[model samples]
Target chain A: MLPRRIYQFFLIYLLGILVLLSLKYGLQLSDYVIPGPKTLWQTALEVFPRYALDVWNTLQVALIGQVMSIVLALAIGIPGRSTTWFGNFIKAAAYNVQAYPIVAIAPIIFILLGDGFLSRLLIAAMICYFPILLTVLGVMSEPVADVEHFYRCTGRMRWQLEVKIRAFENLHKLTTVIAGSATLAMAGTIVAEFIAANAGIGYSIRIALYQSDLARILVALLLIGICLSVYQGLLEHTGSLVKKAWTGSA
Target chain B: MNGKTGKRNSLLAAAWILIVLTLAVAGAPEGRAWAGTLNYRLKWIYNASVIGDLYASGKGYFRAAGLEVKVRPGGPERDALRELELGYADFGVASADQVIRAVAKGAPLVVVAQLFQVNPLQWLYRTGKGMIRKLDDLKGRTIGITYGKNDEIIMRTLLAKAGIGRGQVEFYSVRLDYTPFLRGKVDLWPVYANTQAVFLRDKLSRAGEETALFVPGDFGVRFVANSVVTSEKLFKRNPELVKRFVGALLAGWKAALDVKHQKEALAILRQVDRDTPLRILKTQLEITRRLVMPRSGPPLGTIDFEGWRQTERIMLEQGQIKAPVKILSCLKPML
Candidate 1:
């Protein structure tokens, strides 16, 4: 028997294909509106080689932004876990930042930063920052009474304990947050590229849209989906390995 | 089988039939008893650039031609040709360069009517800050360009022809907003002569500043601008419909450009786009009339094959397109 997760994935894809086929044949819709699976596959094959550079450019921006976001989140979120006014202020700012939509903020970012790689990086970081910070705050604040008592008995500094031990104890949550934010980072990068960039999958999509090349647009979207999935998959796999090595579980 | 089993089978058959019927209805277009529905996707937002299209629809010209027209506005993300390809739209407006590139990529599109006889794309620079008496003045000046757009292609071609290297002029990436240009960061900015340039000029004039327009045509480039297009399949299958649509569209253009019908055309345009000022619309209409039907040029909606060939040639030289797109085959003149 197929594994449960694989079977579920297969079933969803099968349903999508069935719907496309029904639109193509049952209703006799033109190929322009909903292309058949075969056409999509052919388009993917044709455009993948030509657009590899755009994909790589997007991936680089996303990865760099993700790393920057992680570092910034840790710097602020760890201190915000403390009982101080500054910490509370930092938490409040993160929450406020999360409230504004990226689309609304992107044009302002472009104007201030002058439409360069920095603007794209800042946009991606802005999107990835809040989620990671909030997750870190949640994990740090929810220390178990028993764990706290044990750590206090050991006489370690509270900040040191929180940073080295408490945070480590909740590695699973941190990993999950990081994995989730990867998608947001990718999306933010694409949005930034769309508003202002010299090169990227987003730029390619814009050009393809101008040309009315649906096949190229579909290919770009597929590549983006594939990029995000692979990134998420790797993070999850590595996260599991780290969790197993640290906690001695499969 | 028992009575209950028989009843369940009958219900299942009915459900399947209902599902099929619903799907069919959802896929089909909304029923039109007499007039054929034509979805026209414009290249840009509802502005002076698409005044003719708006006029035609608002004045019942399309209705006279048996077409119930829906003039949809396009933006940065909307590709009229892509919509045409997907059957979301029956007609679209795009630049010659865009049409050429699409055809080279195997899109089944045919140009039916050319709207702008001379391309509206040109560079605007502040004359008071510095004079650009000759092409050499462009050197060392910061030029703003929206890369992957036709302006970028035109600018690069101009530079190459002028023997100017990439390092001579700094290229700034242009966004939809003109803050950088307004703030004097960019020395030269690209604008549609008949549309955005009118608004920019008005604002600058109010600030007691003067600007000089640089026409690419004057500088040795005659690339065609917006043109009406439809799928080749439609052109082949419904030649009569294509003829009627083009005839009505050109008639609308002629009226919109005529001085006598200026107020009516602008009124029609205002009905669709209320944001643009009346003064700007009047100036834009004047400029558009000149561009669409110059005193010595072909009439409105005439497809100039030589202009298209030049556009394709420029694209090929710039490596914007891989190969020469058969320009002649893609053009289907209905007027």
Candidate 2:
């Protein structure tokens, strides 16, 4: 029997294809506006070889930004759970950062950082930072009292108790947050590229829009969707594995 | 409490109705006399390039022709041709490249009037850095282009004609900002000669620097620029409306190019685009006049058939279009 999750995914995918087919053949929309799936496939075949560099560039930006954001979030979030003024300040700053719209501020970020890889990286990192940081802070602030008492009875140091026991206990949450942030990182990287970048999938999409090449535009969008889906699937798999190992159950 | 108060209320309601009827009767002639509403989608934001369209509306030309025209400004993502295709706009301004590409894709679009006699796509380089006196000077220079833009086509055509190899020069991709050129990172940058070139020259002159424009027209690539366009369905459905709109638009163009009406045109343009400085608008208007009505060319708004044919040939040679788009069939000049 097929897995329930697998069945659901296929159902959604087929529904998407159905809608596209209806738009193309049923409604008889112009090919210029909405090209059929066959044309899109042909365009992908033609564009992918030429767009390999763009794919690689976008992947690098997203992956690098995701890793950096995770590290920064952990470094700040653990200490931010402390009952102190500085900790409260850090918490407040993270909330503030989440309030600003990334798209509106992207141009300002580009101006300050200049239009290059660093600007794109910073934009992606900014987007990925808050969710991971907030999740870490939430887990740390609500540590299990029994675990704390047990560690205290064992005479463990504060750093050791917090880092070794508390973090390990919340491994599921951390992995889940990381999984979620991965998607945001990819989206942010693409948007940053759109605002200012010479090479990336976003740049290719912009060029396609200017040329009014509907086939190429659809191909670029499909590639972006594929990239995000693959990354999310890997992250989810890793997250499940971590959960299973930590809890000693499937 | 019943009959007296009800009679007073009825009297007040009747008086209000009489007043409304009087107002409607007085305003009906002007309000109901409009022939139709024309949604004109411009190719870019309100600037000197669209001064003629703005001028026509400002001078009551569209209204005089019994039409209510809504002049809409376009931006980076706002494609005039796309708006026309989607039925949101009745008339639009698009470049020859856009029109050709749309027609090639079976868009059923037709060009009604050519705005600029000469294409405005050109390269701007600092004269103080190094003069591009000859075609060979372009070799080894870092040239900036917005890939997939008409400038790319024009530049490639120029290079191919001059026998320059692709590897001879580096092509940089330009974005919305001009910082790369301003920072000396790019040797040459593409710009609309009449619009952006004026602003760049003014900015550079203030900094004690000089810049020179490399017009592709001077290099034998006379691609047509912005032209008024409408869908074939609309053109066939109401040719009279098309003719009236074109007539008013061309008259506005003539007036805009005339020195006597320059002040009036600039005034109208400034009302739409207040951010641009007055001096910059003057300079832009002067360059725009030269482009629209060259000393030794056809009068303003004349559709140059040879120019369109050459543009198509260049696009074909560059492989931008896979097949020939019947250039003349798409051009229906009502002016």
Candidate 3:
């Protein structure tokens, strides 16, 4: 799965590059508008190491952000799974927070938090937790009738047991959603850096953008793609392991 | 027919090709006019800084010149140079650094007219914290600069000229919010002298604070600002069209800057910039006039060749561009 993900990303990146190249040559565009192969290669050589480090920094934030989002989502989701007023209130509040555009709120965050790592982490979690929370809420709310019925009839259906049964039954769905959200986490972190943060691949890309250096941006995108693919692949692999262990198949 | 007849026909064909090539090189006739809706993209949104451009469009100067120009606004994401290459815009406003960098990378753009004779970019600081009487005053100050922006290049140039090392002063990364500057967290925040300077000074004034501007030009750092631009191909192919457009634009500027037409210009600005009060817009326009057309300065839209060269040299010294782009060659001033 990891190898497949890497190759698939490679193919997509290659296709995107080819399309840019075709446009460049087709329209007789200069390197400023669209970087030629030589310029792109030279830019890669120049900025690769710096951008790699930056991407690693971004990924670290993203990984922590993903974990935080998962925790926050599960915490809210598990408690809000009930049909009580507290659950409904929590759902409405989370939805309201999501409605406010992050771009609008990012300035306040930066002003309060000073555009540091903490701000990036919070923005990333804010962006990534919503979809995960929705899925968690759906999965937690829907009763697993057959398995949950066994626990309920014998009066063994405590809230913990109820949650365990539901989570166990929907383990595959939960794993898929969590793995899928890695992209969101990375995207969120990037958006944070692009808006205000000073130390990440997104910030570097912002600098390149200001300079109108398409070659540098292309190089940054390549590194970001590779790093994201590898991280996501590892996440899926870990999720599979967790599933196996949970089912006693490990 | 005789062989002489065939020789005469071949000579005629060659003469026709030579004539056509010569005409193409000399450019189309001065009398010739192009009739089409052309796109003129500004570097910023519709604000007092773009009064002349808006005046031109709103007052039908484009139509008077026998052209239909769609004056489009630019923002952070809108790149006029790229748009020119992609054939989306016929003309644009770009800063000297942008033009030089684009040219360094082989983007075939030509500057036709300079808008701001005195660049509007300056650092605004509160008056209480001792004036920047000399370059030495800049040391030990926490300055706000957008890391990958023109202000950074200008500030670095200023610091280097003052013989200040990187460790000598503090640099705060700036963003859209001015909370840091407002709360007195940073000194020497960059702002456009004509627009943001006016706004910020007024805001600080209400808070019982006095402010001053640090003009880079005053310190002999004359970085060129917004200027009219177009593709080199368009400039070469239709010199008459370029001439007419620039002529109309400068006329619009001259008229807009005229005190008699202040009401008209303000009305046009009010249409788009509804957020700013009329009083502030008036002040911005007055400040803009000084930058766009300084006293004893050249006529409106006059290309500042020396200023552009100095700007290019600064960029080169600062490693913003890998090498000189021969920026003067790209200054195909219509007037």
Candidate 4:
């Protein structure tokens, strides 16, 4: 699965670069507009070590943020799953909070938190939280009536048991949602870095853009794609491991 | 259920294909012209700095020249030089760094006019916190600069010129907000002398704080700022149109910056820059005149050949560009 994910990313990234190169040669665009292959390769060699470290720093923040969001989503989703007034209020608030664009709120976050790890973590968590929250809410609220009815009738069903049963029944869905949110978490971190933070691949890309070096930007994008692919693959692999361990499957 | 899943996947695949096709079509470059139409892109957003470009379009100066020019606003993200090469724009305003960098990369870009003879990008410092009377005064100062922006290059050059190492001063990364500067976390903050400087100086004064500007040009860091640029093809293919367009554009600038035309210029600026109060806008225009056209300087939109060479040399020395672009050859002053 990890190899496939990495391979797919390479395919798509190369295709995109191919299209850009086609545009460059077709329209006779200079390296300034879309860098030639030699320039791009040379830039990759020049900036790889620095950008690699930047990507790793970004991934660390994104990992912590994703964990926080997952915890936060579950904490809220479990409580907000019921059809009570408070539950509806919680749902409404979450929906409304997600409506505010993160880009618009990022400046405020950076101003209050400073452009450090905290700001990037909050932004990543905020962006990665909403989708996970919605999914968790949807999954937890849903009932496995056949199995749940038997548990309730036998007086064996507690709130914890109910959540476990629902989550167990929709294990594939929960796994998929968690794995998919890795992209959002990474993207959120990059956006945070691009907007304010002085470190990370996004900041490097911003510097490249300032210099109008498309070659450097292309190299940065290549590094981001590879790191993101591996991270997302790891998330999916971990999700599958949890499922196998829970079910005691082969 | 299987059929439904297949249908959904098919829809997703179709959507992806449509997106790819749309991207390909949009990315293809062609000199899009209709009825002698022209598109002129700016280096930055609609502000006092672009009074001439705005006035040219607002006052129908282009229309009088039998050209339907669309005067587009620009931002930091906008690359007018790239647009010119892409055929998305017939003419554009690019910084000297952008032009030099582009030329070094073999981009067929030519500068037809230099808008600001004196680079307006200056550092704003609060008065009580000590003055930057000389380059060494910048030592130990927490200077604010946008890392990838022209400000960083200029600041680095300034520091080098002062024989100051990076360790001497705290380099603060500037963003959209000036909170750090306001809260006294940073000392000298970069601002456009005409636009942002005017606004920031006013805000400081109202809060009972005196402020002053530190212009790099005064200290002999004559990095060129904005200039009118065009593709070599357009400049060569249609010299007549280029001449008329630049002529009319400069005329608009001449009129707008003229003391006699201040009333009319303010009225024109008011339409686009509604957020800036008339009082602030008036002061901005006044400051712009000194930078753009001094008493002994060449006419409005005049290309300063010596300054262009100096700008290229600075970039070479700083290693911003790997090689000299022979920037003078690119300066084809239309007038």
DockQ of each: 0.17, 0.12, 0.29, 0.49
**In model 4, which runs have C-alpha deviations exceeding 4 angstroms?**
B1-27, B31-35
Off by over 4 Å in 2: A1-21, A24-29, A79-116, A137-173, B1-36
Report the lDDT tens digits of candidate 4 across residue range B96-139.
98899999998998899889989999999998978778898988
**Tens digit of per-residue lDDT, candidate 2, span B1-335:** 59999999878866765565455434322212124677899999888888888888889888887788999998878878866765678889998988888877668788998999988888999987578877888999999988888888888988888899979999998887787898788989999888898998888889988899888887788888999998777888889988998998788778877899988988887888799999889989998888888889887788989899998888899998889998889898887
TM-score of each: 0.78, 0.85, 0.93, 0.94
| RMSD after Cα superposition, model 3 | 10.6
Chain A of candidate 4: what's the TM-score? 0.96
Ranked candidates, highest lDDT first: 3, 4, 1, 2
User: Global lDDT for candidate 1?
Assistant: 0.81
Candidates 1 and 3 compared: the better one by DockQ is: 3
CAPRI level of candidate 3: acceptable
TM-score of only chain B in every candidate structure: 0.88, 0.87, 0.89, 0.91
Angstrom error at residue B327, model 1: 1.6
lDDT of 2 at B96: 91
Better of 3 and 4 by TM-score: 4
Clashing pairs in 3: none
Against the true structure, what is model 4's DockQ? 0.49
Q: How many clashes (backbone atoms < 3 Å, residues ≥3 apart in a chain or on different chains) does model 2 have?
A: 0
Q: Model 2, A156: alpha-carbon shift in Å?
A: 5.9
